[model samples]
Target chain A: MLNEKIICAGFGGQGVMLMGQLISYAGMLEGKEVSWLPSYGPEMRGGTANCSVMVSERPIGSPVISDDATTAIIMNLPSLDKFEVDVATGGNIIINSSLIERKTKRDDLKAYYVPANDIAVELGNARVANMIMLGAYLELTKVVSVESVMTALKKIFGESKAHLMKINEDALAKGSESIKAQ
Target chain B: MAKVLMKGNEAIGAAAIKAGCRYFFGYPITPQNELPEYMSREMPKVGGVFLQAESEIAAINMVYGAAGAGARVMTSSSSPGIALKQEGITYIAGAELPCVIVNIVRGGPGLGGIQPSQSDYNQVTRGGGNGDYKLLVYAPANLQEMVDLMQEAFDAADFYRNPVMMVGDGMIGQMMEPIEFKDSVSRFDLPEKDWATTGTKGQRKPNIINSLALDPAELEKHNHKLQKKYDAMKENEVRYETYNMENAEVVIVAYGTTSRIVRNAINDLKEQSINVGLIRPITLWPFPEKAFDEVPAACKSLLSVEMSMGQMVDDIKIASNGRWPVSFYGRVGGMIPTPEAVMGKVKELIGGEK
Candidate 1:
């Protein structure tokens, strides 16, 4: 029962890989089995990028989440266009409303839209948009606790970048609040 | 032990360090860059040498040199790079040197793609290098296995005074999983390396490590010695795993990353009451031919599933020796067969539905 397959996709610079890693690391912190696989190639910044992340109680069979993604976090229009159909039936689709003007076409799945970029910018740091989406994912799925995620963030940022931790925390809170408001 | 999440490449690097390997010579390749990258960052801290060789050929020769000097050395690469190291590997084996080599296999015939593939089975097991020598090959199924095998690989190489290989696909290099590193594992008490090319300053005798022998009889004698070592490995080093094979009607043979997928297929088939079993080979060189001997009486057929174009199937056929109807299901060119597809193949082989 403790299994979740998530696909986070966006432009290369949208921190999709980091978002996937954070989820995987948080799952590991909580003693859950996890895997993170990125679509690696010559692609870099501004290129189509995505990562597959799995948090499960049992060992994962495949890291490549081809089609059975339980949730898809689309951070841009192109990402949504590319991965919207990959969401499993009765799955969830969380979209970044700021860049993704279009809505989900599927009727069977629940969709939540948050202006992650706008919220990050309003919170005074645009780099934390991925954190916003991650926060929304945590609130919706509860695969890992928010406390575990914050601890993982502290481990990642560590001493050098510890000053930006508060903004990321704010971004996460704003994301969860946006989901609750709807 | 505290478990930490790590990529397979990073785990291999860490395990190598823990196994007392102080020399690493390799070039960067896709899906396995994290290995050398980790070494580059950590080797300096341990006062070890991590050199990025100019090419795979140079890297392997450097391994030959370091191993000849009695240092635990390793070099890693993917398919194309491994191909380039064959000559050096052959030379190292001929000289009876000890070293570890890793091949994080990608799709190949020649730079085919950067995706995970088990197509290197023949290349790694059938001696891509020119020799009658066999490298003790270990195929790990997961990140933790990769780490554990790395430690064992170093010991095996040193104990046997031969090169040992750890073969995995790109998926094993790229995926992240939880792994716990143990302090140490049991190792054989190997003989003193009086054959090593260490400096002979007022020593008993100077040693030379070379593969060349002009006289055919001398060369043949050396080959016989290597064959003896290989025979001993065959008798003792075979490792494999069997799952749900107690009373199964069909057996599936797989290894490394493919075995996990086959396990998934087996789980699904169990739901349908098909009773499919799996034999996963951990050591590819010894081939675990004995595992095939214990097939259940009710088992009617054997299916070999791999991410290659029916390569490992040949070994299964050889091991089964035509006792049972053996079939092959595979995907090549960087493509991986899903669990459902493998189940479909099992259904086809089993004549559909119990």
Candidate 2:
């Protein structure tokens, strides 16, 4: 019985929406009911962007994560500032320590500070930072496999952008190792 | 085809194209902009025409033009844009043209913020245009239902030779969910387009497409005839769903995105030993008035939940016919009511009882 309400947030260019989409797409591949809702309108243009991703075994009802009952994948400082309190007291918060300096303000949460940006830069592409954060999230929760995510990535990027897959995979590996090493 | 992950706005375009609607005209608007954008990209692949008109009014009139020519056509917009097209919508309705109008609703009294809101309920259901007219409206709850209804809307429009509306909030337009396009099963016996102005080649009488009647009594007769189609739609096209409806204490009535939220509330309440039933209307117009008859006499009361300030409450009250004292719970101006908020409302109403 897998039901995870995930809020993935960061600056607009940080691929936050893509992270949410990948989780949802991977969940669907694993035969789970999933939904992804992106934050649209004015804020999405080089501003803070976020998305709510829900993966469940049963039929999904509301696509909203109003109570923030499950997990938070925060990539930037403002994202952490905004969504840190939104995560449930006993829930999980996977922070990108590369961009965000502060720790979780609440002590009850299981927080993992992964250097997603640093890892992505080391992998030679800062854009894959989101996948690093996603890797950390998957490692922390095991909601969906990194393999399913790779399949989702291939399908999303299609055959046109096939060249970028290697870096993304490396970022996902580094992200997973970041949390496991802790 | 297997289920694919697609956004709600993109799904609308795909569904319309699947339904044999080859012509689309729409203006750019937030939340719903993806719909037109998708059409622009995909319509050409299917040998369809996607035209971004200069304005929303222009787009709807183009729909009217294409519909009068007997072509399956569609146009879409958000709240403020939908308002701009009301006059053309009325013209299409008065002419008895078959076209689909999709309003991916945004919060508004005027040019309001682009967020999910069902504030267009009254504007859509109560005839936003002038005169006595009704557009067959479908309010789909999820991405799957959204595509399903988009396909059905074209059929309904042609079947009744009237404009059919598919209204979903920004939630339905912005969310991405797994969806498989199903073969459409139309509920109406589609009549021929004999009344279309397709240039008869002098083979018969010219079919004049006009909504004008200078004679007072003549226009009255036309209005009366149009009323029959609306009545037939009520008789044949009503769609709704019920969940946990048997002998429940608090019965809820909701539709579209709000209905999904209510479902969560019902499931949560069931764990606490509170029996809650839900009646979700798929068709906003025709009102699903008969669904209220299914409520058990053992039920305590009815609650109408919406993303608006209770526009649908009037219809629920009329449908319930004073059988139960109906109370309304709502969050307006782009604020979506959460399941917890709805639970509190239901418990409040339940607490007052007994």
Candidate 3:
């Protein structure tokens, strides 16, 4: 069982939901039970959108979650404010420093403010910021193998955007390196 | 044999491709829009046709046209958009076309809200369009069911040469869960499509797919034929699930996402030694009345929960047949009642009644 609950939240168009999908896919590829549930509605575009990705060795009981989140990736200020309190003690938070500036407020949980956007920009695509965060989370939590993430990304985007795989892989490597330096 | 976690909408889209569903026509609607977006991208890869129809009506008509041509076709929409497709649905049923229609329902009597709701129960089960026909409606509660039922729906529709529907609320369509497909099931390998309007080149005859029968007697015969098909579907295709009902005093009857919420309520009640269970109907049309017979023998009362105001409750009442006192507790217009709220109702129903 993966035995973890991960949430990624941000504005609708920020690829927050897709990041959750990637993690969920990677988890599934690793032979774990997983679910990805998005906060869906008209609000998904502008107001707020978040996805809950749960991976366990056993069949998941509820696709919906109430607390018990062990990992969070907040791409916006509102996402951080909303989910920070819910992060389990000794959990981890990966914040996209380009979009969010808040310092970690909780001493119990470890927080990493990765410059995901700047890394994505340096990689020549701001849209890949979500991939950067995913890469950082993978290195920090080791929830899934970097190989699986790479395979899942290729499986999802290879046919559509042929060039994105290399650019995004670079962004992911950058994310992993930044975390390693810390 | 690798599993992939995908949203309900994306899974449905992928399953359709895996099932050899080559023609897809749909318009954009919140909650379920991702389905079309997904189809748009994946269809081409599988040599399938994906079209963003101008409107729900157009999309459904395209389904009717494609189905008439011996093609496995599908169209999806939300509640309000589904209402627009009702006219086409009736035509499809009257024509006895084999196609799949997906309704990722949202709250509605009118343009309601975009939140998840099961308000389309009556419209879907009873044939939302103007007719005395019934669609073989399959209701999926989770993402795995969503994929498996879609494949079954396509098969069922083709088996009986009737229009089948995979009906679910927005939550079931939008949520994601782990799923895997064993081998590709091609729609092209189905029993010969003898009833299609394929070009007649020295063939037996040109099949004319139309709902109009001018003679009243002829129309009556057609209606009777459709009724017989509906009856057969009701007998063989009705599906449901029962959990911990042997010694239950209260049975929660719910479907789609509401059933999951009720399961949570049942768990909470079980902790306090309250005997509660659930009967989740997987097919809305068949209505799984036989399950209720077992429920009445054990449970004294029932709680019908849904995202609509007493829609499925009516079906529960009919199924229960006044044998056990039945009560309704639900939310409407996309307002999902929390488990705590639902548990409150369960406690009241158990406590308020002697």
Q: Please write out the lDDT profile of model 3 over residues A40-61, one tens digit for every residue.
A: 7655347888988888886665
Q: How high is the lDDT of residue B321 in model 1? A: 88
Give the least accurate 10-residue stretch of model 1 chain B, judged by summed lDDT.
B182-191
The C-alpha local distance difference test score for the whole of candidate 3 amounts to 0.84
Over the true interface residues, superposed, what is the Cα RMSD of model 2?
0.7
| Residue lDDT tens for model 1, B1-354 | 887878889999999999999999999999799999999999989999999999999999999999999998999999999999999999999999999999999998988899899999999999898879899999999888888888789988988899999998888998888889988755677788888888989866789899999999999999999999999999988999999997888899999989988998899899998888899999999999999878986688999999998899889988988888888899987788889899898888778866
**Model 1 steric clash pairs:** none
- A36-114 in candidate 2: lDDT tens per residue? 9988878646689999999999999999987665999998888788888888778999988888888988898998889
- The TM-scores of all predictions, comma-separated, are 0.98, 0.98, 0.85
List runs of model 3 lying over 4 Å from the truth.
A1-3, A12-15, A43-47, A66-70, A85-142, A145-182, B44-47, B183-192, B202-206, B296-298, B352-354
**Tens-digit per-residue lDDT, B1-354, candidate 3:** 666666788889888887779999999998789899999999999889999988888999999999999899999988889899999999988998898988888887788888788999888888778878888888888887778777788888888888888887777787878777666353434588887888888857778999999999999999999889988888788899998787888899988888877887788788878878899999988899988866747566898888888888778888877888888888888777777777788778777523
- What digit string (tens of lDDT, one per residue) describes model 2 on residues B11-62? 9999999999999999999889899999999999999999999999999999
Model 3: fraction of the reference interface contacts it also forms: 0.70
Better of 1 and 3 by DockQ: 1
Pitting candidate 1 against candidate 2, the one with the higher lDDT is: 2
